[model samples]
Target chain A: MLGLSITQWLFGTLSLMAIMFALMMVFTRSPVNSALYLIMTFFCIAGHYLLLNAQFLAVVQIVVYAGAIMVLFLYIIMLMNLNADEEPRKHVLTRAIAAIIGGMLLFVMIGALRGAEQLQIVQGGASQIGLVKNLGKVLFTEFLFPFEIASVLLLAALVGAIMIGKRDTNINTK
Target chain B: MLNGIPINYYIMLSAVLFIIGAVGVMARRNAIIIFMCIELMLNAVNLMLVAFSTLHNDANGQVFVFFIMAVAAAEVAVGLAILSMVYRNFKSIDIDLLSRLKN
Candidate 1:
């Protein structure tokens, strides 16, 4: 029998991976390495979705975030030929302010989460309800327009990227 | 004896991740790295959403996470484009150097 406690442990492990990889992505000096680590972080987040019983979402997260978006990032990073030379050092004051703000955000999120425990608990498994079909139902019936608009935005982004990434022959000629 | 964690644990972890990302954003000079840090914060928020969704046994939060992921994809695409443009003009992705916007 699958126990709730066991499931929680599984999620806890994946969460640890996610957090560590995220920190790596942020703290790394090399943008190329950071981008690759971010891909790992995305995969861990997908694992969390699977733990939550959102099978469709888990797959989608992998497909969209890990698969497509990350490859896009890698492509751009490589295409730009951005190596160690491009990054510059920041001032101490900026770093200090960032640390202070980061500490505050951490405190607030923890406090809010503690408060959530006092709130009423919900009891039911949407995971058991056939996630993919149900999600499609909602997308088509209720969130159809939003779904279409999302595609539209993606389309615009695609065009815009091509436009920007296109080699500037005009400038080269001059 | 390994399953002692509650939903709160996950939430706390997410909070820490978010904070780290925030620090990277404010402190890091590289525009691309700062953007990656923003993505980290967003993923951290997604982690919290999925955790709560699991705790409550509700799929709505998970659904919201899906939307958030979509939006994040869009944002990254556009933002990276802008950054590349900044690079094209300035030759460096340093945030502090892109001061005048026109220059």
Candidate 2:
């Protein structure tokens, strides 16, 4: 007992789980297993959103990322019949260099963020901005134009996916 | 100070996650796995945005996160479609083998 409160405990646990699963996703060779691990990571992130009191975003994260996007990923993997770990291994030197580069990047970012602790965050008591009603109001009122554009983007993506995924029937007939 | 948990913790967590994703992207040859790593990076950024939203006691950051999710979803759709098309044409999805465009 480090005298930590329940929220702090939960945050620690969720973040640890998230990092572990994310690493597993990367390390696993099987695409299906990688996808499963990524889904677990998404769930942990949803938990963090809940801890942040962003109820709407938390629900959306679960619904969209864990539910829809991951399902699509799995569906594609299955459709392609790529359930095995058939990926050709990269050279050891390449892997080592990538790891070193990533480590350096992390070091630089953490160094830049050293003063983050001193930055004062406003402590607004019992903020309700995370509620659906408040978020919906902001989405519709101030962010209305972007909201509509997102819809159009979704539509374009829908049509484009269908067009790209469909087989070339004309070539087959010839 | 969210329940005595410093905002720095969230920042540190996201930074680590983002690095892991970047490494995965750099090291992996599978296109699907690379795409998943990109998603991981996006989620890391999303976490940071939500944390800042709570820090500022504002909803705007959360709104930005919403738009980001939409864009990510659309991106996944088109990317997967292209991936499947590549598979159909080559009977494989290895990124290294798809280097005909380099010529």
Candidate 3:
């Protein structure tokens, strides 16, 4: 008589898809395919955000992550003209160590999580903090300083990107 | 029997994602793939933050996620530029081949 609700079903499906896509991103031979898989993972994460009622964050995740960042990655991948089998084979030892380290990190984190107290379902009435209007209000008012700083940071990043990416024929000639 | 799912599931899922990202970063030779793995790790953290924010009935976590997204965007721009430059110079983007600085 028990069945998963719409929220549960969505969460389960999205999380599974996210995990699968992430793994594929790691294991796929082609960088372009990996970039595409990353985009899929990002979309799944955005769905998770929506389930949590962080609609604004979800939209931004899609716009910034799936939209802007991923396009940049794909563009770079294309520009480089990378082939599927181009990467030199990693040493077996390196692969083993990486897997072991990853497993240990997961083990430790899960162990720590096991000791935490059981969390009760949040009883707060339908939260509206996720709405763009309310989030914009708080972002501008309470978090105004950080907001300005973020803009400055973006500008700096833009300048830095331009500097790094600009052609320098002198270096090649020398 | 899934009525109200426990918060632990989300935490566990995030942890799994983080681990996958870590492994990808370590195992991948291409710098761009490493960068994508890093992005994956960041997304895992963002998911955890949002889940906690919902649990605590606060919007601050969402705000922080916003900031994180901005930073991530900036990082991707600069990082990919650098990666492309490295590719241009070495004719490959493999991280192992980036040891010319040691010479």
DockQ (0 to 1) for model 1: 0.49
| Clash pairs detected, candidate 3 | none
Superposed by TM-score, candidate 3 places the C-alpha of residue B70 at a distance from the truth, in angstroms, of 0.5
What tens-digit string does per-residue lDDT give for candidate 1 at B10-42?
Answer: 667777878888888888888878888888888
**Where is model 1 more than 4 Å wrong at Cα?**
A1-4, A112-126, A166-174, B1-5, B101-103
Residue A89's lDDT within candidate 1 is 66
| Residue B6 alpha-carbon offset, candidate 2, angstroms | 1.5
Winner of 1 and 2 under lDDT: 2
Off by over 4 Å in 2: A119-125
**Runs in model 3 lying further than 4 Å from the true structure:** A121-125, A172-174
What are the models' TM-scores? 0.84, 0.95, 0.94
Sequence-dependent TM-score of model 3: 0.94
lDDT of each: 0.76, 0.91, 0.88
Candidate 1: residue pairs that collide = none
Per-residue CA lDDT of candidate 3, range A42-139, in tens?
Answer: 99999988888789999999998999999988888888788796666688999999999999999999999988887743422366788899899989
**Where does model 3 sit among the CAPRI classes?**
medium
RMSD of each: 3.7, 1.8, 2.0
Q: DockQ for every model, please.
A: 0.49, 0.68, 0.66
Enumerate residue pairs that collide in model 2.
none
